[model samples]
Target chain A: MKWEYESPRKAYGETLVELGKEREDIVVLDADLSTSTKTAMFGKKFPERFFNLGLQEQNMMGIAAGLARSGKTVFTSSFAVFATGRAYDQVRQSIAYPRLNVKIVATHGGVTVGEDGASHQMIEDIGLMCGLPNFRVIVPVDSNEVRRVIRFVAYEYGPFYVRLTRPSLPNITSKDDEFIFGRGAVLKDGDDITLIATGIEVSYALLAAERLEKDGISAAVVNMSTIKPIDKDLIIKYARKTGAIVTAEDHNIYNGLGSRVAEVLVENYPVRMLRVGMPDKFGRSGKWNELLKYYEMDDAGIYNAAKKLLEVKK
Target chain B: MSDISPEKIRELKLIANKIRELTIKMVYAAQSGHPGGSLSAAEIFAVLYFHEMNVDPKNPEWEERDRFVLSKGHASPAYYAALALRGFFSEEELVSFRKLSSRLQGHPSLMVPGVDMCTGSLGQGLSAAIGMALAAKLDGKSYKVYALLGDGEIEEGNIWEAAMTAATRKLDNLIAIVDRNKIQLDDFTDKMVILDPLEEKWNAFGWRVLSINGHDVVQIIRALEVAKEVDGRPTVIIAHTVKGKGVSYMENTAKYHGKPPQDEEEYNKALKEIEEERREI
Candidate 1:
């Protein structure tokens, strides 16, 4: 897989513009992060349909639900911390409980937000969003997947929380790859072990696979983007076939892709699995790439986890 | 108020008393619901369903129909009574309120017909109502959006945030009614959290503020009628009302905020008060 990085938020903003042109009922709301969330593109195109609620994530969520009740597909954008954390109760009570058609495409998921540190880095957004009933959570891997997920959630009638990273993702999953809602996309097939990943870590898993094979361990890479209504069959299938598993994400090891994957395997087909993500702790101000390496969530992290799992397998 | 006829005033008063009667009955029967705030909001609901708003109970999902959000959602008894009287749902469904497999949820929800938005979580419904108002403007629909909020519920910061949105967007089609009954579950609203000069707060938020006697059927209807005429800005009615207005013992009492009738005597007494008021009307 070629590793050319691209902004998922940019794709989100651009895709929203395209969707706005097609569907007149599609309205966009941003809580003062339109430029960063890339919702400014849609706002620039459709001024009347766009609302900048100005640092009011909680109120913005309620507005999103209200518009949805009135038969409009509403998309809301903000940093993940404020989007999911600040307005969690609003999302839970207003959007998720009623099952309104509001898409909360939060940018800056995980520690990739960087510099702003622990407060802005929302590593638990996926867990928070997935905990709610009627909320379908997705963390798109790259720019292509981001576009597809945004477009998909618009037509699908329900509440959605699509997590995107602040840093552009390295191109790993191609545009041609089929993006299914509740199914994991296997980027590479291998028999030795399966490397399951999501969001920015999908590219890291693919990159780690290259290093793993050179170390004589053939690794399979699967992008488990949909966190809720997770692809249990895929996890079970890969768990049985490989006999060992390694999960990676840009989120916490708890209740994220790893925890979810472990839950599925433990109930169905248990395997020797290693979770490669942040230890349960807060992150400090640093460069995002340096932070990824410091947290050991880069290619070397997945590669090292795979080798350790293989040793245990032996 | 003069323009509203004696017959129409008499009918609205009867409906308001009926709403109060049904509210107390529903709460007392459930043995687990709010009656104080619901009682305070009875006349507001009565005027909305019976006189003020443009809506069709037969077609609850009518796109052009005016929308209402019960922002202070625990007050479902009064709202349900008004909707039932207006034919949104059968009075039989009132028994199922706050029950399992019942469309009448503890708070207003989309499952119930004529409930424009699911609300109960304080301070959020106004924003949803603003969304409905904004949608109407986008679609070029003339239907207005109304939301009933508790004075206590406004203590939530989200209400202020939502207030900013309503005025910033100049949502003239939006009108919010604050059930200023003066008592919350814990204590009188001023004792719990001072919300005095509340109208000035809404005024500072750039809303067209109206103050009226919330319990008076004529005043409630007249205020609502005035609210619709205000142009280019949203309206917020600071309706002065007594907590637990109808029943003698419950009036202005905090205990009834989350309690039902304790005994048959209390229930019958409450019922008699409601019935006597109906007779006078």
Candidate 2:
């Protein structure tokens, strides 16, 4: 099947415009990076509702909380590092503690934020957001799912954290695919090993599954987009069937997708698992593809991890 | 804005005295809470709740009503006293200030009837007020937003960021009151971090700056009225007040900043001082 590449940030910006037209209560805020985060698209359409709070991520989060408290559905955007790391306390006390109706759609997540180095790339955003109570974390696989997730969180009345990558990704899911909030999407079915992935790594997992098929190893691919409130039933079903699992993500291996899946498997059904992601180290200035390859988050790396998991299962 | 009458000033002063007494009693009951800042801002709270703000204790969640955020959340006793006196809740609940099951926590929380935002950490409430003011402009509502900050709380960098945004957006419907009580948890505010030239700083940030005596009800009310009439840009009222205005023993002392009365003799003396002030008014 032929696939096209699209930017999730662009999709998020377009969806915000659409949502603005539909709901008058929807307000968008950005901390001086609207162009990079693609919130400038919404700003152009609804200048009255878009607030440009220049370079103040902490104050932006607090303002988002206050807007939500006044019955406005607020969508705030910034770089992943600033949104999660710089203003974490504001997010916790103002948004998460009170459970305000705010959507924090952070862009440039993970090592895909190429050339910006460790300072800009946020590999621990998932862990940071997931640590907060009443915050639902979502990382869409591609631009198609980004639109669905945006629309979903717009109407939903609660706090949420949606992460978007900087680099464009291949469209893996179709337009007809349903984007459920907490449910995982199964792209392929197999019995030998299960490959659970999220964000841009979903496409890499699919490529790894194809390679594993040639090696006489059936690899099941599951898109665990919603990191918090994770699909435990789907993971257990795949664990019972495949008996081996490999989790992939464009994040640190410690407290991200791999850790969540390992927690689920250990509690319900014990299975041989391997985590394919950035090891415990900061990323340097490099190209997006080079960073992924260097961190062992590409198709070849995922395939190797799956083979290693299969060997451990034997 | 009309001139405040002598009777109105006397009434507000009495109310401020009652609020101070209530604050001392609540802190004494809690045995662990901020009393210095709370006592200092009693007049500010009384004027805003009883005279300036367009709030309804009966309908606490009124859509078009004015909003107040206690940025210096440790001074929640003052806020709770004002809210209770305004009939948002019973004055009897003041005894349950920091109890586990009480609606009144150590800081201001939204679970309380009259409170709009949950603020315990410093330098956050002003940003929330800016958001509320912006929302009113977007929705075409006439409601105004107000926030009160401690003198020491302005040391946080986030406060400056929010101040700049509030000015840049030209939030005329927003008014911020700085309770310049001159003391914090550790020591005097100037000793901790010199916020002198504070009025000049606000003027540079593009806000209409007003300096007033925070312990004077008439001055506080007049400043709020003038702030409402100011056009285009937001207003900041720098209210100079003693650390513990009514209590002679605790006045200008950081010892009572976050500590309650030590024993019976101290508590009685504080109560007697406020009661005498109320009678004099």
What would the per-residue lDDT of candidate 1 be over residues B1-281, giving only the tens digit for each residue? 34888988888888889988888788877887899998888888888998888899889998899999999999999999999999989998897788887898888888998888888888899999999999999999999899999999999999999998899999999999999999888988899888989999999999999999998878887777878885889999999999998898999889999899899999999999999988887
Q: What is the C-alpha DockQ of each candidate?
A: 0.87, 0.80
Deviation (Å) of B254 in candidate 1: 1.0
TM-score of chain B of 2: 0.98
lDDT of 2 at B198: 96
- Model 1 bad stretches (over 4 Å): none
Worst window of 10 by summed lDDT in candidate 1 chain A: A169-178
lDDT of 2 by residue, A1-314 (tens): 46899989999999999999999999999999999999999999999889888889999999998899999999999999999999999998888988999999999999989899999989999999999999999999999999999999999899999999999988998777889989999999999999999999999999999999999998999999999999999999999999999999989998999999999999999988999988978898999999889888999999999988888778
Which residue pairs collide in model 1, if any? none
CAPRI accuracy category, model 1: high
Count steric clashes of candidate 2. Answer: 0
In model 1, chain B matches the true chain B with a TM-score of 0.97
